[model samples]
Target: MNRVLRAALFALVVAYLIAPLLVVAGVSLNERQVLFFPPQGLSLRWYGAAFTDPSWYRPAINSLLVATFAALIAVSIALPLSYVVWRYRVRYAKAVMAMGLAPFALPPVITALGALALWIVLQSYGRPYTVVLSHGAFLTTLPLATLTVGLQNLNPQLVEAARTMGATGSAVFRTIVFPFVRPYLIAGFVFAFVLSLNEYIIAYMTVGFTFETLPVKIFASLRYGYSPVMAAISVLFFAFAVVVFAAVGRLGDLPRLLGADETD
Candidate 1:
């Protein structure tokens, strides 16, 4: 009876969480321009528009580019920071790690505002690259945390053996450390990429009207009034998120990457 009750509660919770997305998906199927539920009739035209329409397509491409570059930048920053802290136990490592995480710890608006100010001061505001930099800095924490976890799970004996075999520091890292943590690296990159793709505040604040990510574009489209295209885009994004996460789960121990124990 207890197990049945728990299952029932779980189903209810899932339904509550997914209800809005289901509604959006249903609305995306509407043939009319108006946002309507039960969708007057089934149509995939909006989906086609989401991909082919310049307004949606261009911003989406920009978002992908920014996300890719931002994820790379985040991983570049996190890999060394995590490695030094884990491998060398550097002094003030915790403080340094905290700093890496500070951007994410603060409110997004605060970070966005700060990025805006900095860019303006440097007279670099409204540049396309500014959003990329802002997102990379803001999303560094994901990779930092994931890499740290991977480093923690690494066997010290493996390093020692490599060193005993006359492996140089770079060689050890290249051959062993990297391979061991590669999955975590990929996980971190994906985490940052997905978040960056969906991010609006920092991108908007940094580039304003000069650059538009998909999230920024979606919000911008709202000013013109409602359209089924937005709903179609939402469904596309949802499908994308599902596919990416599913791939990540298959490629890595998703639970452990999320801080679950090996035993769990």
Candidate 2:
């Protein structure tokens, strides 16, 4: 009875989370040109429209570019930074990390305004590359934390064993430390990529229509009016997100990175 009750509760929670996606997907396939779940009659017109429209495809490409580049830069920086902090236990590392996490602690609107102000002062407004860097700055905190957790989880004796074998610092990290933290390194990259992909406020304020992205386009579309095409785009967004997450989990223990004790 307890197992059944637990399972029932889990199902309810999952359903609550997934219900909106299901509705969007259902409406995307609706034969009628309006949003409806269970969707009148099924059709594929909107899916075709999602692919062929320039407005849809352009922003899709831009988002892909931004998310890819932002994740790469953020993770590359975080891996080394995380290692340095963990290895040296530097006097000011905690203060530095606290500052890195400040953007996340504040409301996103505040961060968006900050990014806008930064771009303006630097004369980089409306540039996609600047937006990418801005996102990297904003989202670095998570990957840093993930790397820290990964490093902390490593058995200290392993490092000592490598050192006793006359291994140099780089060699010790390359052979001993990296393998243990590999999962979290990958996990951090995945988290950074997904968050950057879905994020809107910074992109909206910093770049706007100049280098429009999928989220920005979605906001524009919804601002104008909702349609079956928007539903189709939403469904595609759901699909891409699912793919990113599934592929990443194949490379690492996602739940563990997310604070789960169990590796599985």
Candidate 3:
């Protein structure tokens, strides 16, 4: 395609992705109580309402808590697991890796159902920590994959050099390996955090309608008719995600982390 045509196509794709979010943000600023396009007037009433409302605040807090814990847990698990896979290349490496990633590859509903069933069998009910554990189970795979890719691109000779300098295994890892892979680690953590924050089905199935996350709150709000508060929530979520990912991109070659060709 010609440069002009390619540019136009890119712009079109951008518009298609951004349109709904822009509309939601615009409606959030509308002075009217109900959501409407081309808002009657601009105001921050809905934003204020969202913050002030316990109903919204509660769910937002729950989502934040879950996402934070999930990110930490996923990174912790993925780090060692990925290190083993990359360094050892064990006989069952492929099988182990596939099992780790199976949850993400399977249909979400099926995974949720399976998780729910497991939770029931294990008698873990109404436990927020268990919910975090369940979310982390699937989320860890993304970070593992991301870190593995980063490791693949690294020079193994560096680790050997550190060892030759009398560095112990832990010392070499901490001093040499960690710095090079830190960017990928951050990228993976953010990926897991964002995915967990936006995820609904597994969370809904595991926690049920009794507990609410941001997405679940939004879904519930739909039953009571569209409100400007929902739009405000949507805007907040979108802005937060964009700012986070943009920060990550600024710190690292984000396209490479996403498995995109750096030359392109």
**Model number with the top TM-score:** 1
Task: Using TM-score as the measure, name the better of candidate 2 and candidate 3.
Answer: 3
Across 97-151, the per-residue lDDT of candidate 1 in tens digits comes to 8989898679889999999999999999999999999899889999999998899
Whole-model lDDT, model 1: 0.91
Off by over 4 Å in 2: 1-5, 262-264
Using all chains and alpha carbons, the TM-scores for the candidates as numbered come to: 0.96, 0.92, 0.94
lDDT of each: 0.91, 0.85, 0.86
Model 1 regions lying over 4 Å from their true place: none
> How well does candidate 1 match the true structure, expressed as C-alpha RMSD?
1.4
On residues 145-209, what C-alpha lDDT tens digit does candidate 2 reach at each position? Answer: 88888887788888988899899999998888988888888788778888888889999999999
Better of 2 and 3 by lDDT: 3
Which candidate would rank higher by lDDT, 1 or 2? 1
Error of 1 at 145 (Å): 1.0
Q: After aligning candidate 2 to the native by TM-score, how far in Å is the CA of 35 from where it should be?
A: 2.1
Return the candidate ranking by TM-score, descending: 1, 3, 2
Clashes in each model (backbone N, CA, C under 3 Å)? 0, 0, 0
lDDT tens digits by residue: candidate 3, 168-234: 9889779877887898898989999999999988888788666788888888888867789999999
* RMSD to true structure for each model, in Å: 1.4, 1.9, 1.7
